[model samples]
Target chain A: MKSLLKKELSFYLNNPLGYIVIILFAVFANFMFVKDIFVVGSASMRPFFDILPWLLMIFIPALTMRMISEEKRTNTMEVLLSLPVSETQIVVSKFIAVWILTLIGFVLTLGLPISMYVLTGQVGGRIYLPEVFVGYLGELLLAASFIAISLFYSSLTKNQILAFLASVITIFFLIIFSTDFVAGVLPPVLQSVLNYLSPIVQLSNFVKGVIDIRSIFYFLSFTALFLFLTVVDLERRN
Target chain B: MITVKNVTKQFGKTQAVNDVSFTAQKGEIIGFLGPNGAGKTTTMRLILGLIRPTQGEVLVNRLDPLAHRMETLQHIGYLPENNPLYGEMKVREYLSFVAEIKGVSNEEDVSTVIGQVDISEKAQAKIEELSRGYRQRVGLAAALLGNPHILILDEPTSGLDPIEQEKIKNLIKKTAKNKIIIFSTHILSEVEDIATRLVIVSRGTVVYDGDKPKRKGGVEKLFKKLVV
Candidate 1:
């Protein structure tokens, strides 16, 4: 299991994809955060927190789209499955590799928050550290769920582009479920049910410094469910 | 010993393998010969438990391969058809990774297998940069790690020059003692040179399984007569 994880990490670190994703993430995320800081005039990270899901929707899929698809495309999945490894191990290793890479991208963007802190200190504005920490945790959980979903899609097909598109479409629905457009179209009871399932609603609680255990459980369980599905799909190899 | 009994693999509407049965004991090299889409690779996959048999069973050392996958895999080393590899990784790095998976992470084992396959010179090069012959060598070297009891190679010499083919044949010959080696190939001369036993499949069914014919004209005449 360790060897498989190491090999997955090597593919990420050695190839240009890992660095490219991180670099684009840092640049685009910071750019949007900075743009919102001057307009909001309170050094708040609300805009950053709001834009994070969209950023991850694109980037996480890009990172995970090739995780299983490339192995199938090149027929290396045969070699991988023939090893003394189980389908669960392969799925977990791929999940951990993408999670770690997302964590690295998070670390690089720490400078954005630190800069906000220093600017707020000099200008006599208020910024809550607790809320920022909670918001970052929320984003990490969201990214984990996205990674799992993207990996499931990747395992379904041998084409990376198809995987990427499927993941993006799925995440788009998850994000929009809590919006007014979706709410207006649904009956009130169904709206409440969809709201509970919407990632946006769950993520909003974290961004507000609520620290609700239900949201955390929701994210974790969603991640686990998709990973389990990926393992089952891979085991159904023809 | 490797035993494939009445194995059939059906993919959707297509039957890739049909009621095939064969057994090879230790110290025997079985050359699996068949034309394109003849189910050679599918049979090998069944033995490796990459795909389950539709209506039959595959056993490695008297245990069901699907039920005892890790144990059977530990005893078997397979070089799949087309020799798929991580093209971006260095040969040595790739082998080391495979060694770690095989529970033989010792550097000495990796180095020894590299030497055995005569690919020591290209060990530092990326797999994509090596020629077809060297890539096949790296695959063979990976299979040789952990000193597996059964070696299943699918078309190990499908596309190589005469000299490279001879080298691979020699490597198989040198490693054939006390191990069940089953390799598939289109080259009749390869079976004539190294195979002690022969199994030929046509259209997903085994048509012949017996001792390699020692008479003049060798496997060529027999294959022509039996395959079609």
Candidate 2:
């Protein structure tokens, strides 16, 4: 499993296009977040966390769209399956690779939050660093779920473009299902269910500096569910 | 020994393999011959545990490949059809990755196979940069890693020139002394040249499984009689 993970990581890290996309995501996301900091006149992390899911909807799918699809296209999946590695290990290794790439982008945006926190303190403005850290944790969990979701799509199709588009559409719906306009039109019971299912809703608590265990559980379970589905899809191919 | 007993594999409505059975013992080179889409690759996949048999079992050294995947896979090295490889990777890098994946981290095995296949000069080149013959050799070198007991090569010499074909055939002959080598090919002459046993399939069912034909007609006549 370690070797498989190493190979997956090497593919993601060594590919020039993959590396550039990751850097572009970090720069663009941080650029958006910094723009918000100046326009909103506060060091609050709400804008960063709020816009993160949108960024991830595009970025994570880009990272994952080629995970299994390329293997299938190149017919290397046959060679990989012939190895001693299990379907679950292959899926998990790919999930971790995309997850790590997403985290790298997240880490690059750290300078903005830290500099803001320190600058705010020096200027006698109030900014809680722990709140930003908790928000980071939530965003990471959300990114993990998105990575798993996109990987599941990647496993379903050989066309990377189709995988990316499918992931983007699915994630778009998940994000919008939490909105007031969408939920307000639904019955209260269904609205509550959609809210529970919505990653944006789960992330709201974290962005508010609340370390909600239920939200954490929701994200972890969501990630695990999609990863399990991906493994099932791969095994079905075998 | 590899035993595929009454195996049938179906993909949705299409039956790719139908009640086919064959066994290959060590030190035997089984030339698996059939027309296109005649379940040759499917059967090879079944033995490698890449896919499961729908109706029966495949045993590698008396253990079910699906149940003992790691054990069976460790005993078998497969060069799949088309000889699929990570084309962007250098030959050495690709073999090293395969070695690591197969739990054989010994760099000596990599160098040895590179020399064995006479791809030492192209070892530093990316796999995509090599010709089909060199790519096939790299694939063979990967299969030879860890000294697997069984070698399943599907059309390993396809698309190569006559000289490259002879070289590959010779390598297969040289490597078949102790390993159970089952290679699928369309070339009738190749079977007559190197195979000790022959297994022919037509439309997903085995038509012949016995010694290579040796009477007035060679494999060409026998293959036409059974498969054509």
Candidate 1 per-residue lDDT, tens place, A56-160, comes to 999999999999999999999989888888899999999999999998988888887788788788878757889989998999999999999999999999999
Residues A94-118 of candidate 2 have per-residue lDDT tens digits of 8887788888888889888888878
Candidates 1 onward: DockQ, in order: 0.78, 0.72
True contacts kept of each: 0.78, 0.78
- Candidate 1 docking band: medium
| Residue pair clashes in candidate 1 | none
TM-score between model 2 and native: 0.97
lDDT of 1 by residue, B63-103 (tens): 98878888999988899988999999999999999999889
Residue range with the least summed lDDT across 10 consecutive positions in model 2 chain B: B213-222
Top candidate (TM-score): 1
Show where candidate 2 strays beyond 4 Å: B215-217
How high is the lDDT of residue B63 in model 1? 91
Query: Candidate 2: which pairs clash?
Result: none
